[model samples]
Target: MALLLLFASPLTLAFTLEDLKNQLSQPAVVTGPFIQEKHLRALPQPLQSKGRFVLARDHGLLWLLQTPLRQDYRITAKGIARRDLSGWQTLPSTSAATEQNRLFFAVLQGDSSGLQRDFDLDLTGEPQHWQLRLTPRSLLLKQVFTHIDISGARFVERIELHETQGDRTLLRMPESTSAESLDDAERNDFAE
Candidate 1:
């Protein structure tokens, strides 16, 4: 019975919110291809876009779209910016956009404490596979999103946004790999 108890101890271990945060935060940089689907209430089909993303723990995210049309976006603490012929042009940050950016950063960076300010987070499953549900706690956030569902194994694999008006946005990072640091090009993009 003592041997059996010892073997079962690992199986009985509970995976908590803090464990999830630590697991996600372990990677300094993650690069992957993504598929984003925007489901509008009035549209018959969702709008799909393919892109590659670079997420750096200390800096920001670089969203480089390759299909349909090529566009590059850099999201940092200041705001969102787009790449053009001249240079990186900062986009106007509406309240909704700003909030969305903050939420995205929080989710990707494993900032559960920061998320608790405006959301009631429900986390489930083990470290290898987990699902997180975020319900809006603030009135402002409640007005825009009904709930947000995020799931992953080690890193964030998918994010689904359920909007108030029956619109939904699905982002899937199907293939992601961790890196020690960003390349020179990615580093330069963040600097700009």
Candidate 2:
């Protein structure tokens, strides 16, 4: 009976790629307050931090880490930008050296199809709320992240990254909005 019950459990069910594709088809923006909890095996306790995220389609993203320290990251077609109170610095666009960061960009850009080429993707939960588990296929990415779990439905609510070094970072995103339009900013930021 126990064996039968184990085989019948819903947890044993696996999700298909179509399910993930369908979820990404929805058009929406997700802005929110966030908290990042970093846990290192060598540390006594998890280090907590706070932040926010602004996600818009066709435009780009603004990821701001505010708590433990203030930092900002912006990703656009031109490249990735890191900013602080001092100034802003731009990094090369998705290229060979930054494949790991590019993979992250692909995921955030809602291009799961592209991401599928580099990582094994899995999904769980209902339509309203779901969990996306990504396991890196590349040796370099695998060295950094064993797996990445992103939880949320229409909008991402949380992201947990499990690193090969026995460390993890849990990022929680609360529902919110961005007043500034990202498209116009991207255009200006990348003006030639």
Candidate 3:
């Protein structure tokens, strides 16, 4: 039947990792709302939190959380800083954290070749729509994240983080653009 054929075709289709690598190679800045669902193995239900993320290639990363409580975290080449409704605090960038930050920056910069050494990557779906799965090969990263799944086309659609503690957070990217430059404040807020 025609209907059966349509369903069967989709079930048998798959995307390769090379396809996903190519999709992520494009240059762009992505900013959007993100919903982080933290599922703990011991918890009865997953805790949901909402936030927004701004990522610029030359800049850094700005993560603003508006749900559960108001908070903001910025990661840049300088380091990672967090601010609550009250005040701002800077956190030391451990070697491990620096490595993680570099990894993220490298990926966003479209240096997929650099990432290959650190992650076992696999791609699925089609070029227009696909998922990139990155499993950390380093012992330090393996201790933190089990794997990271990124889905999207030329721009990232969503990022799913699977932690070693069995907690998973899903971040959805809704809006994105390419910028020639960012202001000083935006640069400071998103440095790494």
Top lDDT hit: 1
**Clash number for each model:** 0, 0, 7
Residue range 1-192, candidate 2, lDDT tens digits: 998988888654644445555555345555678787899898999999888776665656667788788888876555678875566688666565366456655665446788788789887776667777899898877888899988766656677889998899887776654444545654453342
lDDT of 3 by residue, 14-76 (tens): 555544555454444566677877788888988988877777665578888999988898777
Task: Give the C-alpha miss distance for residue 50 in model 2, angstroms.
Answer: 1.2
Model 3 CA deviation exceeding 4 Å by range: 1-28, 84-89, 107-110, 175-192
lDDT of 3: 0.73
> After aligning candidate 1 to the native by TM-score, how far in Å is the CA of 58 from where it should be?
0.9
Off by more than 4 A, model 1: 1-12
Clashing residue pairs in candidate 2 are: none
TM-score of each: 0.92, 0.73, 0.72
Q: Candidate 1, overall lDDT?
A: 0.92
In order, the Cα lDDT scores of the candidates are 0.92, 0.70, 0.73
lDDT ranking, high to low: 1, 3, 2
What local lDDT does model 1 show for residue 37? 95
Model 2 clash tally? 0
